[model samples]
Target: MNVYLAEFIGVAMLIFFGCGVLAGNSLKTSGSYGAGNVAINIAWGCTVAMVIFCLGDISGAHINPAITIMNAVMGTFEWSLVPGYILAQIAGGAFGGVLVYLQFIDHWEKTDDPHAKLTIFATAPAIRNNVANFFSEYIVTFGLAFCILGMGTNVFLEGLQPLATGCLIFLVGTSFGGVTGAALNPARDLGPRLAHFFLPIAGKGTSDFKYAWIPIVAPIMGATTSGLVHNALYKGIVDYRLFAMVGLTVVTFIAIKLASEDNKEAIKNKQALNQIA
Candidate 1:
């Protein structure tokens, strides 16, 4: 099979199991309804492993546009193939979302909340602050790409790469996934969100396109930053510039969180004042 085809199938499998888990957990009347975040984190990690184990040899099982873009920017993957890889992954994601919709058609009708139905197809912010959400995605994907780059080095065992990568994903989800549902991949979020927008799932509700760009843009920025630092560190230069870049990113992430909290507090105070008046 062609590399592009393998990427498509691999990512499609990723979406199939990943979103399928979401649908089962969120949609009413499903067996896994109310299963909670731990189940979701576990399922998503396992799905990543499954796809990589199956297609790793064919396409390195990127299964993520962020990974593909990072690899290309880092010069580990050919830039010429980046476009095709992204398109294939996006297509796969949409296909996976469609499959989930079909599987849970009855459940969609049973679930009256549009947000729940939409979440089965894509991610949304827990706090809904754009800057904070963007930084959350940026930091999460930075961690993802950074760890993935480390895992790809010669130190790790070759046969265990997929399992290691899956574990890394699980760690990310549990540790840093709260803000924006941890959408560390553009295709993983965007494609499914698009599916939710177009597909006629009864009362599917708005796709929340306003915040879609956070998942897409933030991941790319994070990936690019990680790739550059990883490559520089891999080359054994021990450059201080890498540290500066990382420190700046950390500070930015912290600032966003603090700012968002301040904004929420202000809103609450204003509400209280209005009530008193």
Candidate 2:
């Protein structure tokens, strides 16, 4: 199979299962409504593993751009191929998200919470703290890239990488995922989010473009720096770009914090008003 085509298929599979779970959990009329964290946690991990199992041999099953970028950073993947792979993943994810939306077309009217409807397609912050939400994405994605590299260095059973990623996703979800929904992949969130924005879904809220940059930028920063970190610790290679990236991230988030204070307060006040009403 063509590698780009494989990536498209792989990520579509990812969104099919991953968003499929969210759809079930979020749609009030769905059987899996209120299935809660355990269901999503397991579904995401299993979905990743399934994508890998089906497409690992073809396009390396890089359903996530973060993974694709990490491979490029580590020199295992071609930088030239990176753009195509990422584009394919995003398109595929959007395709899958739309399919799931159509599958539950009736449920949209049945479920009144626009936020819940949005959750079926994209991630949202549990607490809406831009700085912390940004930091949390980096933390989990760093773990994701770092551990994936760790897995690469060691000898595991021939078919074990998928399972390893599955378990790792489970860990990422249960641990720091609550803050940002662990959106470690830009394509996973952005693709479906774009769909949500343009598709005219009934009662859908803002696509949350203001918060979108965190998932895209933070995950890339985390994944790439983890490659640098892995090289420093494991290969005794201290890439100075690692420190540069860190310094830049710190400055970036500080600015984000300062600029977002009023927006954050407004959001909090809105929530408070909702509670009072």
Model 1 spans > 4 angstroms off? 237-277
Best by TM-score: 2
lDDT of 2 by residue, 10-103 (tens): 8788888889899998888999888888778899999899988999999888888988887787777899999999999999989988888888
TM-score of each: 0.86, 0.91
Cα lDDT tens digits for candidate 1, 122-204: 88988878677887898789888988888767575666888888888888988876677898999999989988988999987
What TM-score does model 1 achieve against the real structure?
0.86
State in Å the error of residue 159, model 1: 2.5
Give the C-alpha miss distance for residue 52 in model 1, angstroms.
Answer: 0.8
lDDT on C-alpha atoms for all candidate structures: 0.85, 0.87
The model with the greatest lDDT is: 2
The reply for model 2, stretches above 4 Å from the true place, is 261-277
lDDT of 2: 0.87
